[model samples]
Target: MEDQREIAYVESVARGWTMEDGEDLSAMRRALREVRARALPMNMSMDLIRRTAEERWSS
Candidate 1:
């Protein structure tokens, strides 16, 4: 259940949407932090993040 929620949050972020009322901001921030941390190891750029978000939204 938590996994599904996290996925939804990621998809929402990818789609360039803001968090709606009652959404978990902390969790979303944590998720983003985790993504950044992971991406850091790969030397991923902000452009890559934007592209990834666009791709996720399109899919």
Candidate 2:
């Protein structure tokens, strides 16, 4: 419930950005890349991560 609302709010905020919006998407991609880089060496499967990323953008 609360988590859904928070996620919705974050998505809304992200959608408000244009290509000119500096650093937001870059920072997110960087953070995600860092996390993926670290997790892959530890054998983490990123299927869910990919799905979440796709779902967010496709929404």
Candidate 3:
């Protein structure tokens, strides 16, 4: 499973959003960590994940 930091970084990149500095960034990271921890795992293959990511970015 991917860590919170990695998930946050990927989400930021995917949405083309700039990560703010200071306390806001810390809060955001904390929230993401919590959310990720509660999320269910998907039984998908790497190819499917890659394809989905590609499709999302390509749109």
TM-score of each: 0.34, 0.33, 0.40
Answer with 1 or 3, whichever has the higher TM-score. Answer: 3
- What is the Cα-based TM-score of model 2? 0.33
Candidate 1 shows a clash count of: 0
Best model per TM-score: 3
Every candidate's lDDT = 0.63, 0.56, 0.65
Clashing pairs in 1: none
- How do the residues 10-31 of candidate 3 rate in per-residue lDDT, one tens digit apiece? 3444475555455767788788
Please identify which of the two predictions, 1 or 3, would achieve the higher lDDT against the true structure.
3
lDDT per residue (tens digit) for residues 1-59 in model 1 = 45554333335434755454345777777787998777654445777888899989876
For model 3, which pairs clash? none
lDDT (tens digit, per residue) of candidate 2 on 14-58:
475333234665666678789877775432457767777898987
Which is the leading candidate under lDDT?
Answer: 3
Give per-residue lDDT, candidate 3, residue 27. Answer: 83
**Model 3, clash count?**
0
lDDT of 3: 0.65
Clashing pairs in 2: none
